[model samples]
Structure formats: C-alpha cells, structure tokens
Target: MNSVYVDLAIGLVIAFLLFSLLVSGINEGLVRILSIRSKFLWAYLRDMLDGAEGKRSWIPGTIREVFARLPFGNKDARPKFDPLPPPVRSTATTWSGRLYERLREIDHNTSGRTSIAFVPPGRFAVAMMEMTATEGGVPAMLEQLRQDGSPLYGPLKGIWDSAKDDAEAFRKGVEAWFEGEMQRLTVLYRKYVRWVIAALGLVLTLFFSMDSLEYGKAILTDNAVRAQVAATADGGAAALERRLRDKCPEHPSDPYACVTEILASPAFVQIVGNAPVSVRIPDTGDPQWLWNGGDWLNRLVSPAHWPGFLVTFFALMFGAPFWWDILRRLTGIKLRQPDPTP
Candidate 1:
C-alpha cells in the first residue's frame, strides 16, 4: 500500500516537472521575442540618468516617445520625431535637456541606435565622466553640478571627494556604485519575472487541460498506468536532470536554443508521451473528434476541475529548476526503497 502511494507521488512529480519545463521553455521564448531583459535595462538606465529632479511623468505622449526610441521591435513602425530646431538643439539649457543631448550623442556614436541594451561598468563611468566634464576638470565639474542644481550633485560630489582627484580612483568608485545598483536591479527584475512566469503557467495549464485530480486518480487507480509512468520517469530522470543543470546563463546569446533543445530531447519526448493528461488529436475518420463540446464546457465551467487546474498552475509557477531538484531527491528515495518480496 505504501509503495503504491509512493509510485503515485513520483508519477505526479514527474508530470509536474515536465509541465514546468514546458512553461519555462515557452517563457524563455517570450522573453527573447519581446527583448524583455533589454527593455528593463534601458528603463533602469533612463531613470538613473534622468534623476529625480529631471524625471518626467509617463504621460501618453511621453510613453509614445520612449517607445519610439527603444532599439528593439519593428523599426519602420516606430513614429518619427521631428528634428529639434538649431537653437534649441545647440543650447540644451536645462539639466534634463543636457542629459538628453548627451544620450543623443551616445546614440549617434553607436550608429544612430536609439537604445542601449547593456552598459558595462567601465563604459557607464566613461559616459558619466563625459556628462559631467568641465574645462577645469573634477573641481570645475563639482562647481558645475552645484550651479546646475542637479539632484545627482550630492552623490557625484561625494564620489569625487572620496576619489580625491585620482582619475582611476574616480572611475573605480563609479563602477562600484553601478555594481551595487545593478545588484538591487537584479532583485527587482527577478520579482517581475516571477509574475510573468505565473501568468505563463496559468495559460499553459488551461491550454493543456492538465487536471491534477484526474491525473492523480488515473495513476492511483490503475496499476498498469502507474507502472508505465514510473518506469518512464525512472528511465528519463537522469537525462532530464543533466539537461536542467545545463546553465543557460553561460550561453546568453542563445538561451532559447537550450530550451528548444530540451523540448526536442528524447527524455522530454518519452516523459510527455507517458503523461496522462495531454491534448491529443486523433487521426480517426470521425470529423467531430477534435471538437468535444461536453469536455470543453466541463473544463471551462466545472468547479470540480477548478482545484485541479489551480494545482497545475501553482506547480508550474514553482519553475523548472525547482521540480528538477525534487525529481532528483525522489528518484533517489525510490531507488533506495527495498522491493516487495514475492
């Protein structure tokens, strides 16, 4: 009896693991397609550079202008911005206007690129140096900051004071500051990603009709089905574990390719085949086989199935790496357990 329950739990874990991988893979694809990381980085830089005093409210027009400047997406679709008049362009009086002109200069240097997806610490320090440049160097720059009434004046002054006029020390201080801010930014980005993962999990759960209760009952009641699922999971567990351990961060240029490879792997194929709840299109002569009105309606509105859908959704929200770790532990336990005597 205990062994039967163990088998059922293992089967469920394997199911969740597979589904989580699917959700994660789809999420990775979306991230790449939308250039989410790059956009987030750009937003962070905009806020940082503009400073509190220079910041503008994100009204509809402002939103449109920002959208037009992003480097990603359809270039032709972006709305054109009329060139500023010579006097206005040449004399950027306000601090915000000067910052904008500096960014424009940077963009021009980068072949008219409107947005920068990533900026290394050294490069950021260089940009800052250029932004704060004065004829008399650091002291003059500090005085300029005071005169301009820029919000960053305090922080810049502090950094400069600590550097004590050493150019190398000043650059390093700027780099350190950027690194510290980046750490905080990383945490915020992770939180945003969790919300995205949860949303994708919900969509995948509905699309696949992966009812946890139904799958659990099927595995628990049927000896043959349970045995098959357990066997398949056992066979493929090691391969899947290795695949999960392969870090995509090491291959940022094409992380989506790693996901695509996982989906195409034999282990994933086998596990997905053994999955009890899945969308399948029958090749039979019956034309109505694809459209099951009763099943669709039941899945849509049936309260009994709601709990199952919720279970699957939450399980997937746990993410692929999490379930892979569970799979490893459970597989170890299953192997360690003594087999029943005849």
Candidate 2:
C-alpha cells in the first residue's frame, strides 16, 4: 500500500514538473520578445535620478503631447489637461532636468538607444565621474554639486567629499552606491517576475486542461499509465536538468531560444506523450468542430476540473528547478528502500 502511494506521488510530481518546464520556456520567450528587463531597468533609472514628483508631473504632459500631435485624430479632440502648468518639467533648469539632459545626450550618442538591459558598475561609475567633471575637475564638480539645491545634492556632495581628491576613491564610492541600489532593484524585479510566472502558469493550465485531480486519479487507478509516466520521468528528468543548465550557457545570446528548442525535443515529447492528460480542444477533422463552441466551453469551465486546474497552476508557478529537486530526493528514497521478498 505504501509503495503504491509513493508511486502515485512520484508520477504526479513528474507530470507537474513537465508542465512547469513548458511554462518557464514560454515565460522566457515572452520576456525576451517584450524586452521586459530593459524596460524595468530604464524605468528604475528614470525614477531614481529624476525623483517620483518629476515622473508624476511629466507623465500626463507627455501623454497629452503625444495625443495632441496625432495626425489622424480630430484637431479639437485633444486630451484635456489642467489649466495650471506642471510644477516640474523634464526640461526645467533644475538638477534633475540638467542630469536628464546629459544622460539623454549620452544615450543618444550610443547608437540612439533609450535603454540598456545591463550596465556594469565600473562603466556606471565612469559615466557619473564624467558627468560631474569640469575643466577644474573634482573641486569644480564639488562646487557645482553644492549649488545644485536638489535633494540628491547633499548625498552627491558627501560621496565626493569622502573621496578626498582621489579620483579612484570617488569612482569606487560611486560603484558602491550603484551596487547597493541594484540589490533593492533586483528584489523589485523579482516581485514583478513572480506575477508574470503566475500569469503564464494560469494560461498553460487552461490551455492544456492539466487537471491535477484527474491526473492523480489516473495514476492511482491505472497501473500501466503510472508505470509508463514514472519510467519516462526517471529517464528524462536528468536530461532536462542538464539541458537547462548546459544549453543556456552554450547559447547565451539567446537563452530563450534554447529553452524553446528543449521543449520541442524528442525526449520532452516522449515524456509529455506518456502523461495521461487530454487536451480539451476539439479535433479539427470534424466538419462542425469550429462551430462547437459550447462543447469546448463546457469542457473548459467544468466545475469538476477546477481543483485540478488550481493545483496545476500553483505547481507550475513553483517552477521546474523546484520539482527537479523533489524528484531527485524521491528517487533516492525509492532506491534506498529495502526490496520486499517475493
């Protein structure tokens, strides 16, 4: 009885792991296509350097400006704005404005890119030093910072002052500051990614109709199906793990493509085929299949499938690495258990 329960659990984990891998691959593809990392980095930098007030003030004005210039729209259909001007503008003569202008110029010079997906600390420190430097170097930059009158001015001045005329020291200080901020930025980015993973997991669960309850029952009641799924998982799990680690490194320029390729591999196909789940989509061979919307909808929204759907959704979000570890531990336990005498 215990052996049967263990086998059922193993089968379910393997099935969930396969679906998790698919979700992860799809999410990576979306991330690359949308340039999500670059956009997040750009937004963070904009907010950090310009302050929240500056961002809030410019967004409405920018939207209006964009809509106002639309050639096809009604000439009088422009979005209404407050009669009062924004207290802070991107082009105003404030510290943020000046910094924004310099950064824009730098960005334009670098092949007209508006955002960079990655920035090394050394390069960032160098850019900051160059932005502050004048004909008189550190002393002039210090004086300029003192007169800037922005909230960041004090922190900027202190960083420079602490350097005590050593250019190398100043650069190191800037790098440290950037690294500290990056730690917080990383946490924020992960929170955003968690939501993305959850959403992708939900979509996959609905599309595949991977009801965990149904799958569990199938594995428990059908000895052949359970054995097939378990054997495939035992053989393929290590391969999948290696593919994720090795393939991505070999093709660093397009890790998402590598993930997609892995999903489409023969080994993965075998694993998925052995699983007992069924796709809810109607077969296109039927003449009226396209018109059978009610049948399709009924299968998708059936109350009996909801529990399994939720289970699959949460499992996928837990991700492939997690299930891979669980599989390893379970397999080890099974191997260590003493064989029963015939």
Per-residue accuracy of model 2 over 259-320 as CA lDDT, tens digit each: 55444443323323322342323224533312334544565779987887888888887789
Evaluated at residue 55, the lDDT of candidate 2 is 38
What is the alpha-carbon lDDT for the whole of candidate 1? 0.59
lDDT of 1 by residue, 1-342 (tens): 788778778888888988888878887887666666656665565445444323442211233443344324333221112234223332544453444444443342232323434556766777566655632567776677677665556877889889988887888898888778778778866765676678778877776666787787766645443344445555464543443344445444553444444334333233233332434433445433234445655675778888988988988887777887888887774446676886
Return the TM-score for each candidate structure. Answer: 0.61, 0.60
Stretches > 4 Å off in candidate 2: 53-115, 134-136, 142-152, 224-296, 333-342
Question: Where is model 1 poorest over a 10-residue stretch in terms of lDDT?
Answer: 73-82
